[model samples]
Target: MNIFLINPPNCGRSIPEERYGITSLKQIFRGEPLALEELAGNLLEHNVRILDLKADPDGLDRELREFPPDVVGITGVTCEANTVLQLAVKVKEACRAIVVIGGIHASNDPGFFNHAAVDYIVVGIGKKAFADLVCALESDTDASALPGVMRTRPGRALERPPLRNTVADLVVEHSPNYELVSRYRSHYILEKLGITMGFVASAFGCPHRCLFCSIQGQTGGGYLTKPIETVVRDIGLLVDIPVIRLVDANTFGDVKRATALGRALFESGLKRQYLADIRSDTVVRHPEMLRQWQEAGLRAVIIGFEEIDDASLLAMNKANKASMNAEAIAILNDLGITIVGDFIISPDYDEDDFDRLGTYLDTRRIDLPMITVMTPLPGTALYLQEHHRIINHNLDYYTLTNAVTTTKLAEERFYSRYAALLANSHQNARL
Candidate 1:
């Protein structure tokens, strides 16, 4: 069977890719469609093609008309819901193909895509389930029985249970078909390093219970990891790319496991730098572990210093103090590793709060300070607690740059202040 997968164009947030830069946000944030790349790897028996709309948005109609695959699969986040649906409609109009949609958006809100063009939905970890679904489609068999899949039929939606295991098992045997996306290699770049990059998932899920986080809800609140050997092998396969970004929710969620992976990479004889996310407490507890990775080409660590106030930290159930964030920043600075600090700007923030945040980042001299307005994303504890307060239900506005709830400051004034902060941070960023 012929298969085609697409990564939809960026929508929702006007936030910059490296929130501290003047470059076009789209250029900085354009990533290779790793989801499509993995799906292509799983469907190795079939002819597969991928089109990342970020790289070429106008090519979709052309591909649908020219290639005319047997199956057209699309994956997107909550913000890309409308865009994916529209793409599905266009694919159905252009070709005699089945449209299957997956990813966090489709999984969380299956009912929203009650369109006739959407033939199927894969809800959870999609590696094996997707391959199985494809085989069933090829054989013209009943697909409702497949795990982690939902089939659309006349006046009915067929459902199945989610897979009990994680995709780490598959990562051991197969890496994303990075070669398929070789044409758009220059588009997938790391802003800090200013070079081409590849994404590798070292682990899955997060064990922490931050109130605003949706990872626990998505992954059944459990953490799973690939073997160190598997991770090293995946990194080696990505040798063509200079930088590798571990797109894990928490690469250091398990300190010991992370340390083992770092040791393996250091000894692997591969000359690739890496970037990953780390919790403040993890850095505080294991600075030396990061030091080892630094020697092994760990360029920077993205830390979510969510808030500056202890009370706010406790409210979010971040399980760490403001002091820990400061300490972690100091440690990374001392280690000579770049730090990408992410902070949430609550909708309730007044002019005073914005000023305070600016002062904090300036005082710390954070390398790249990324800011976002606090959004109550669906499936998160914060969403459940503040569902009634959500004035905007449009997924596009939930990009974290826009306020979906009421704000203390006027919307115009709030955005102006936010824009000012981004410009100021860029000017202050270390050259």
Candidate 2:
């Protein structure tokens, strides 16, 4: 069976443009489609290939004409749902291949892809389900009984167990097929660091219950760490890249496991730099562990100090307080680990709020401050609570940079301040 995986062209708001200056937007962000690589790894026995549309948009038609895949699998996030659907339509029109859509978005809301173009939906952990589907297709057998695989038939929507149930044994033995994306190395970069980068998933899902986050729902409200040996093996596969970005939502969710992985990496004597994310509360509780990691090639950390004030933190159910966030910043600074501090702007933010936030970032000396408008993404508790308030159904604006809810400040004032915040950060970032 010939299977092709595609990372559909991105249509969502660009993270770098919103946080980092637009000058570095294209340079800093464009990551390799690591998810497609993993799915490719699982189907090693088949004629498998991947196409990252961001790297080569025109290549899709060329690949379809020449390779002619029997099955085409596409993945995307909520903000890219429209793009994903359109791409599926294009694939169906161009080739007679079975179209399967799976990713965080599909895992959370599979019903959206129950259109004429999409034949199957692989929810939750898709490696096993996808591989099984390919095998069944090759043998001309029905694959609807497989866990996490949903088949769309006329007048009927086949159901599987809740998305989370399929992830209980998600840690597969196969490493990602990094060789498939080797041609696009230069296209995937961390511009601020000015280096070629590779991605490794050391863990999956976060343990936290932040109301605004959809990750907890994805991981069945628990944490799963890939075995340390497996992570090391995965890193070894990407020997061509100099920097390895741990792409887990929370790399240090389980501090003990994370420390063990760090120690293993340090002992292995790899010279590559590393980056990962963790919670503010974790830093407060495990400052010493972070110190150990700093010596283990840990160059930077992306942390959510979601809100700077106590009331806002409490309202968001962040667990950590404002003082804890400050302490975490102090600890990261003392360790000399570069900090990518993340903050959220509420729709209620006025000029005073923006000024206060700017002052706080300056006082803390954050290496890179990433700010976003608080968005109630679907599958999150916040969405369930505030779905009524979500005036905009356009997923494009739900990118966290755009406000879907009414604002306390006038829309013009809110947007201008947001732009001003970005401009101010670019000036400070140079320092």
TM-score for each prediction? Answer: 0.93, 0.94
Per-residue lDDT of candidate 2, residues 226-336 (tens digit): 889898888888886788899999999888888898899988777778889988889989998898888888888999998988899989988889988888889988888
Per-residue alpha-carbon lDDT of candidate 1 for residues 388-411, written as tens digits (9 for 90 to 100): 999889886667777789878876
In the order shown, the candidates' Cα RMSDs to the true structure are 3.1, 2.9
| Candidate 2: 10-residue stretch with minimal lDDT | 19-28
TM-score of 2: 0.94
Off by over 4 Å in 1: 13-28, 153-160, 167-171
How far is 164's C-alpha from truth in model 1 (Å)? 2.0
